[model samples]
Target: MSKANLSDNKMSATCSLSEELMALLPQTKESFKLDFSEKVEKSVVILLHQARELFYEGKMNECLKTSETIRDYSWEKLNTGTWRDVDKEWRRVYSYGCLLKVLCMCFKTDDIGEAIRVCDMGLLMGASILEDILVKVVNVLQKHLQHGKRPETKIEELSKKKTKSDHTLAPAVKLGTAVPILQCPSLEFFRKNYLVPQKPVILEGIANHWPCMKKWSVDYIQEIAGCRTVPVEVGSKYTDEEWSQRLMTVNEFISKYIMNKNDIGYLAQHQLFDQIPELKQDICIPDYCCLGSGEEDDITINAWFGPAGTISPLHQDPQQNFLAQVLGRKYIQLYSPEESESLYPHETQLLHNTSQVDVENPNLIKFPKFTEASYQSCILNPGQILFIPVKYWHYVRALDISFSVSFWWS
Candidate 1:
């Protein structure tokens, strides 16, 4: 009879539909063995089912508590090993717990903004559980919610001012040889000359066609994904002991890290294109990746966004990488596979791919041979793509507020 009552009925229907969808999710296969210990696996299964049952029975508070228990247990299991070592089943269980928890919260408190925030937290912090049901929930809830107010313009203005006045150039490195630049070479020529020979080359004019070349900017991204949660890397580099990751809204990241410039925070090496598909529409996968397995799924796309001075330590990757500079400038120094002996790669298995020596301010006393290592350096600008062959040791530092997309293919 009234608009408020009509809105309430719609929300009720949405929640009911969500619950039905959750019920329809396939149960875990009993035949498949989980990688966790038998005790952990048993707890995970029992707790997950209990959380779901409690939620279905309409015991929202109890359901929330049970879901939290499952989340904490699974998280402890996750922390016991490296990210790669963690079992996918444990991640799945953890994500399901998050889903149940968020739903219970929504059922108890009819706060659309808080509901969206919780869903975002699960999407960023949790794993792909139930075919990414959290994203679906976000889409459904977004229809009922209005967009938040724009961020303060002072930060925007300050960033533009800094970009213009802060002309601090990249420190002149000793390695003077610049990477060879090529204008839109044919796919056949690229494959034959650089890809086959495993040589590094910077290509121009190819990425000019991408919409991001013109449409993407700090203000634009903030306007689009300001409220969405994302994982931000804190500190100068991953090698630093103080380095750590935090999950926050993209707006918060921009306010505290990018615009404020309080500390170095890089949103590096994340599949942001997958998280925010709207941004992915702006760029296309390079044809050069077809030189590898030719499967679209084989290519790994990662987004790197950070302010000036964020450094990627000298490291080698197992697959060929094409680092495309979409915004701002970056100073990149690369070493061929032949120079591995001089690079002084870390001894530990975890850090073996990363070099121990700091390429920028090298300690020649400890790494005497680093000086003899031949390196090709470049000031990669917007719209340029740097093709790095497999195992090419590269050290990257953002010369300004930078955003780069990297495609890694075998």
Candidate 2:
């Protein structure tokens, strides 16, 4: 959606949405809340990396400023996208805000208590994170306290309260807020037989139903998408898939993805669609498209072939993502929306924490709060379909050589 549309669009219907979102959010807005999707998680990773780099470079002031900016931007972004958990974002901002505040204090040379106080301000903004940060304050003070600078009595009191409350939740019950549990099948068959429910699975039979299937393939996509000029970080790669879902012009997607695909001179995007006027006709699409009903005018696809370590970080699209596995299996770790606290989402909106955290060996220290995450696992087969709901946080990696098609639909 464009900025113009946001202002001119029928926001009257959505005005109440803003208020509802705010109320759902926890008092704390320091952390992020990545629900049954992946985008927000990726955004958080980027912030963590950026913050670490800045801290290491001794640009603490710059880093702090950027954190504040990201916090505000994330809220605005979520506000614009109706798909996000507005309430969760509210709490998330504060949770992460607390983390940033704590980091800021760690770097302060003057008074540790002052730094804790500064971080504690997030309590007013993101109370959950503030609570955690406040608990840590006395410990930090004790570590750096000079002479009798230690407020031992207050610190002990805080420590006792924290110890009283700290407890690992069940695999199902999430930390922080109490909400209803989402029941999912064991899906053991999909997990064990497949690559531990990792690979993207495409239902070839279903492709027969999609209007675009056989008509769109490597040969055809190459004609429409074209062997184009492109840019990348290290290598350039792309993939395509045809599915049979809606009975219409082009089955579903001419989805073109390229490895390390960069912006400038990306011919695959500029030419392919322009060349395929057949694809431009009144594409009715569907109500659940990732880009929604009308935006098919601006869509593209690519293929991936080269890479052992090639990985798409934890993230998600605003649409209902349909991923089909063609050859290899890719391990996927998905967290539900209810596990928002565990994900520690980003403060900004459009940009998710694309950082792919190793869920298996999560650097718990780096993502200390990640221990709060609760997720469902799955592995896609040659014909399996992974229905990734909007905003769910997913971390994926190829278990081996693999091929797949991700239909980013609403």
Pick by lDDT: which candidate is best?
Answer: 1
lDDT of 2 by residue, 1-410 (tens): 99878665535323333233233334443333323235456666567557645654667687777677656665564556463335554545644645554455455444544544444334323434423543344334334433454222332343344332222221222343222221232345334532233332222343333434335333343333221222222321121122111211111111222212221111212222222334333122322233344365433333332222344556655544655454445556676656666666555654454433555667888788777766666544344445565566676555433345554543
| Candidate 1 per-residue C-alpha lDDT over 1-410 given as tens digits, one digit per residue, 9 for 90 to 100 | 89999899968866764565455444543322223445456767777767767766778899999988987887787788678887766767777777787778766665666677777766655677656777777665555454544465645687776765334487564545888999999999999999999999999998999999999998888866777778899998999999999987788888777776657898874657766777889999988788786588878899999888889999999999999999889998999999999999999999999999999899999999999999999999999999999999999999888899999998
- On TM-score, the candidate that comes out on top is 1
Which residue segments of model 1 deviate by more than 4 Å? Answer: 1-46, 53-59, 110-114, 142-155, 165-167, 170-176
In model 1, the worst 10-residue window by lDDT is 28-37
- What are the candidates' C-alpha RMSDs? 4.4, 25.8
Q: How good is model 2 by TM-score?
A: 0.34
* Quality of model 2 by C-alpha lDDT: 0.42
**RMSD of candidate 1 to true structure, Å:** 4.4
Worst lDDT window (10 residues) for model 2?
243-252
Estimate the TM-score of every prediction: 0.84, 0.34
Scored against the true structure, residue 383 in model 1 reaches a CA lDDT of 96
List the candidate 2 regions with Cα displacement exceeding 4 Å.
Answer: 1-204, 208-227, 233-306, 347-350, 353-356
